[model samples]
Target: MTTAERATELRRLHAAPELLQVVNVWDVVSATAVAALPGTRALATAGHSIAATFGYPDGEQIPLHLMLDMVGRIVRAVDVPVSADLDAGFGDAGETVRRAIGQGVAGANIEDQLKPLDEAVAAVSAAVAAADAEGVPFALNARTDAFVRGRDRSLDTNIADAIERGRAFLDAGATSVFVPGMFGEDVVARLVDGIGDRKVTLIGLPGVPAPARLQELGVARLSYGPTTQRVALGALQDLATSLYDGGVLPEGIRPLN
Candidate 1:
């Protein structure tokens, strides 16, 4: 599909511009399960999900090759679009961008945690340039670490930093920027307000609001990083145990084919 058409399709299904919902699928089964859900239009890989399934935490543990293989399977399993959750982009800025584009992915989450801010900006910028050079519509959801560690950035300071990062990313041709782990309606309102008209798409998550709530705040995207992973586990656990424990199985529940 054309980039503009693809981008527009991504938007209309999402409804809030860059505001898209993502499910962390660790395997093909998970991908298939989520693809059946009607509210979702895209799939996002969780580095943590890959690492955890491989007996590691989310901290730069999973090999990029392994991650890419899983990403490939997710793409194969569903007809919808897929984005790689490349933690810290997995390399220097340029390589990060290059690898993602090389993978035939539509978008990625590149963070600034593992490097200094200036370096991170350069990397993100190069990645964006790479996307442009490839002539593909790639989305880069820039992840800032300043707010994650609770390093004392007030709402305004955080907003200012995000706007600066957002501007740089947009200039680099990034499709959008994701600010994770932030909450509170007022804070979200301020970020959208502060970035008025610059128009770099904004995404926040792990605590993104419901559709109605996010629409009211003017957020362009809402991604639920690992939330679905956690809940799905809870769901199957609840289901399997309910029958075993004689906990209110509904009518026609005993068809063991």
Candidate 2:
């Protein structure tokens, strides 16, 4: 399918009755793995994972061109729709989104942090408009960092702030609102209730219930972020340690046939 078609499909997946579970990938290998999964419907990139693979850090530390190249490679590798987590849009949200659309990204998660709320809204709106101009049904997942940045504030205040930003993002043409670092059943429920009809996206957190439980709590989507990469790296660390100690190789490691 064309990227436009893929974008349309991704939007439908998010708006569908069933929950949208995205396994964040960094490269073609990971993207191919996720695409081959039985239940996988689409793909997303974890900025931190992609950056780390290139020996950089997340938070826009990687160059935009390099990130776009990585995303383009993944898009070329997978048949399923792919979404990119373009952290702060590499200092130019609109331009970054234009490049992403050109690279065949069906959707993206753009975080609203390190910028004023109104400015962020305008940037997000520009992305939405750009997608429209290109005739791609792009799914714009606008993220707010209130929970992480405002933890010192009261819960009610944080919820209110989230709701405010979420509403603004939705109004600005974002397909979904992501409140990362917002976990717990009660907290998730509150976000769902407070956000009303708009789709609420939650980042996966340790000890949090599975997607089944999250769906039960009214979450529209769940993403693993960089946790999958961390797990894979951790396993590699254990393997190297065992090898250094002259211990038996791990079960999963085997010479190519």
Q: Which pairs, if any, clash in model 2? A: none
Candidate 1 residue lDDT tens string, 1-257: 54434434553544444345576677777788788789778777777777787777796777877877777777667767767788886666567666665655667778777355678788788777777787766666676654675457586677777767766666665666666655677766766676543232334454545656766666666666666677777987998899799877567753322
Cand. 1 Cα-lDDT: 0.66
Q: How does each model score on lDDT?
A: 0.66, 0.87
Collision count of model 1: 4
Candidate 2 residue lDDT tens string, 1-257: 99999999998988877889999999988888779889999999999999999999778889889999999999999899999999877777877888999999999999988367888899899889888888888999999988878878988888888988888999999989989884678878888888754389888887666888877777778999999999989998998898899988657754321
* TM-score for candidate 2: 0.95
Best-matching candidate per TM-score: 2
Q: CA shift at 128, candidate 1, in angstroms?
A: 1.4
Candidate 2 segments exceeding 4 Å error: 251-257
